[model samples]
Structures are given as C-alpha cells and as structure tokens.
Target: MAIEIKNTQENFWSSDFGKEYTDRNSRDTRDWDKFYLDTYGVTKTTINEKILGNLPKDAKILEVGCNTGMQLVGLQKMGFTNLYGVELQPYAVEQAKKYTQNINIIQGSGFELPFKDNYFDLVCTNGVLIHIAPENHHGFMSEIVRCSKKYITGFEYFIEGDVESVNYRGNEGFLWKADFCSIYKKTFPNLDVIQKDFYPYITDKNLIDCMFLLEKK
Candidate 1:
C-alpha cells in the first residue's frame, strides 16, 4: 500500500501543479473574460443576484485561495469596489495581478489568513474548501469565519454526507466532496444558512456544484 500524504494549501499550491492551473488562463484577454462562466457557469451576475445581492456594492470582500483572481475579476466587473484575495501559489498571484487591477491579490495560505477578525463584510472561498484535508477542515473554516464580519460564502462541490475523498489525476485523497452547508452550521452553531443554490454542469451529469450563503447570528 502507498503511504497517503496530506497535502496542505501551502505545499501543493506552491508546486508545479498549481502553476499549471494558472497557466491555463494566463496570456489571453478573451480567454480570461468569460473563463469562470464558460467553464463553471459561475458568472458575476450569478454571484451578485444569487449569493450577494443583499450586500452593498462597497462591501469589503475577501476570496481565500482566489486562483488567478478570475472570480475577483468577475466581482469587480459587477460594480463591487472593495475586493481582496489570498492565493497560496506565487505564479497564480503574479498571474492574478497581471489579469486584474485595483484589487489586493496577495500571496498567502488558507490555513492562516493574515487578516484581523471581522475585517470583511463577506469572506468567500470558491472551490477551495473541497481541497482541504478533512481533519484540517475545522481550522481552515474557523480562520475563514474569523476574518468575516457578516457573511461567509462557499461555492464548492457537494455530496450528501461527510467529507469523501476523490482521486485527482490518479492521486487519491486530494479532492473531496461533502455537504458543506450542513458542515458549516454544525461547525459554527451561531451561523445560519441564509440561502443556498445548486447547479449541475451541462457537460457533466452527476456532478453538482453548491453555493451557500451563511450569516453569523
């Protein structure tokens, strides 16, 4: 049997695989415009009307593990002025800055976000929580909530029950899927699920992407 290693955000995202992830969207303007929408159907309008319509346009927002900052770019185009992001990959950070302007896209880890408690109006993680190891999920989630003042949002893969590992490129225990909304309410009892939405990709039949908007009570 092979020894299963836990890949932290700090380590795996700094590796070449992470760089390869960003290289997919870099060096092309047209490719960057509708990247999130064309790929995941997650558009600036989807985020605005569905997830964050309640909040003001000037709300301070932070995206943890904002890969290439395309999502942040989408939010920016939606009239959101206060946008911020933390990316573990250096190449992703460089690419993000080059791709979008007037946004604070810093290089950092999701394990320990470098921000004061209750700093942002909404703290978000898009497709980020699914990658964290199950055991470390609590710490990561706690840090995310710690940095947010009002809301916490997650646009992630959804499964029915507990965290289940999935193989990524023949590597096991890297990607995961679970009921994140339930987990979030369980993890933080005071937080309530304000809204939730689900979307299945047109290209893939079985996979469902879920987004949950959670509010601290």
Candidate 2:
C-alpha cells in the first residue's frame, strides 16, 4: 500500500514531475564518476573516500531521496555491503532495483522514514533538502536526525543567510538554498561536524554546493 503524501513538496516529487526527473537522472557508475569530476573537480569515489572511507565496510548506510541509487552503487563498488535507499517516487525505486545489486531500495518518504530510530550508522541526502519547503524543514531534519545512529551527511546548495527559493525549470516554491548545515547544528546540538567542504560550480563560481558529515554526540 502506498502511503498518503501530505506535504505539497512530497506530492510534487511523487508525481509525473518526479518520474521525469527519474528518467533524466538514471546514470550508471561511470556516468556518476564523470558528473562528479566535471561538476565538483572530484570523482564520487574520492568524495566518498574522504567522507566515509574510515567506516567499516559493513556499515549500514541509508540515502534519503536516493533517486536511482547511483550513489549506493558507488558505495557498493567501494565494498560497502549494507546499502539502502528511500525514494518518494515508485518509478525511481523501480529503476534503482533494476540497476543495482544487493541493495535495498524502497519507495518511501523522507518526512516519515520507515526505519526505527538510530537504525542506520550513516543517514544521508544528496541535493535533496533543497527541494523541501522551508515550512517543513524542521520536521524533515528531525527525521534525518532520528534515523541516524551516528552520522548524518548531505550535499546541498549553500547560502550564508536566510532560506531562498530558486525557480527550478520554471517551477516556483519547489527549490531552495540555504545554510543547511547550520540549521542541523542549531536544531540538534548533539551533532558535531566531522567533515565539511564547499564545491563551486565549474561554470559559475558564485553558485556553490556544500557537503558535510556530522556525528551524533
């Protein structure tokens, strides 16, 4: 049975718009390597090594809004055996299952993750939080914090000040950028920063993306 999506942003991602996104973003491992290299001047492997290499290969990792599971594929290639993903769109979940091996991909919502509290060693999101509306940010962050037993990590558009919405492909109120790490830190003080870096868009340096790993204290 499909869960009822209550949030407007959640509905948007579970609709045709989200399926279109899934179609456009169904990249394999090689494609992701090139994308990270081109966009961030580093490969996904290097980024994962920097942020997660220290953890054991059996570490349980969950990526919220995993799209088609390319990121989990990357982790799998790195020898991580326990990889899981939760995505809002059923199409994306199906695509992920088709492409990946030994990975658990499920259709679900980030707002109400189906996992128990502190169930995963690392909970992550990539370019996901920006799509959530500002009014629901706290609830979303709380879920991430609740599900993460040790670390919470993500990569997102970064701004120093208030939340700012950006028009995404002519759609309004569906994308936003802000200091997401600061919000997590302020909201859950038990989380301590483990690793942080900013990668600017190769074409426009003004547009920056930030990634961080935070450990629950």
**Candidate 1, superposed: residue stretches over 4 Å from native:** 1-9, 25-44
Best by TM-score: 2
Worst 10 residues of 1 by lDDT: 1-10
lDDT of 2 at 116: 98
- Candidate 2 lands at a TM-score of 0.97
Clashing pairs in 2: none
Candidate 2, residues 95-156, lDDT tens digits: the string is 88778989999988888999999999999999999998988888999999999999999989
Q: Which stretches of candidate 2 lie over 4 Å from their true place?
A: none
Error of 1 at 89 (Å): 0.5
Query: How well does candidate 2 score on lDDT at residue 15?
Result: 86
Clashes of each: 0, 0
Residues 1-217, candidate 1: write the lDDT tens digits.
2112235544665788778867864544446546646656765466557888768999999999897887787787778999999988877888776778999998777777889999999999888888887888888899999999999999899989767888877766668999888998998998999988887775677788888899998
Residue pairs in collision within model 1: none
Best by lDDT: 2
